[model samples]
Target: MRVRRAAKGVGDFVVESIGEAVAEVVLGVLACALLAGLALIAYLSWSFSPLLTVAGTGLLSLFLAHGAWGTFRDPVEGRRRRGWTAVAAVCFTLVAATAAFLLLYASDCGCL
Candidate 1:
């Protein structure tokens, strides 16, 4: 009985450890895809008119925000991976906000 109990405990620990690693991997992949998507959207929209550029980025921001919420809602169990995804979210927001601001400013100037 003692041997069996010890083995069971070890097994549970291993399974739980794997769960955290899986969470980390899943969130990491999501973070990579998100960054790539944002990059693609920016590149594709670069040549569009100022209004359209802002619109494209605005849509991207919505999706990114939703993803971030999801990340926070069910966060990864690993510290390192969670930190990375958080960094990715921050980077996306900063770049998107800057682009949106610049696009709006340019459009306003163009109107004048």
Candidate 2:
């Protein structure tokens, strides 16, 4: 009886772990799909209107940077602060680069 109970418990644990792994994989796939879709939309918008796309992306980057700054300022137990700081820096760079590109290449597009 003891042997049977132990075997059942082990089996249950293995099944539970498998379920959690599957759930994580599914969620990861969904996230990738969502990101891909967003990238496609951004690309289409950029092709349609470079200025508008750059403006929208710049605004988004600013918001992301602000949020990252706020998170970084708060005390965190782990390495999250470093990650947030990197995000903030990347966002700032993105905004600056986009603006520079717009200014340098503005004459190429007669739409402006």
Clashes of each: 0, 0
User: Per-residue error at 37 for model 2, in Å?
Assistant: 1.6
Cα RMSDs of all predictions?
17.2, 13.6
Shift of residue 88 alpha carbon in model 1, Å? 24
lDDT of 1 by residue, 14-52 (tens): 999999999866655555555557567777777556688
* TM-score to native of every candidate shown: 0.46, 0.54
Candidate 2 residue-wise lDDT, 12-111, digit = tens: 9999999999986665555455455656898999899999999997887677777556554766666454565667766766656655644554424433
**Consecutive 10-residue window with the lowest summed lDDT within model 1:** 103-112
Off by over 4 Å in 1: 55-112
How accurate locally is residue 5 in candidate 2, as Cα lDDT from 0 to 100? Answer: 100
Candidate 2 segments whose C-alpha is farther than 4 A from its true place: 69-112
lDDT to native, each model: 0.65, 0.68
Superposition-based RMSD of candidate 1 using all C-alpha atoms, in angstroms: 17.2
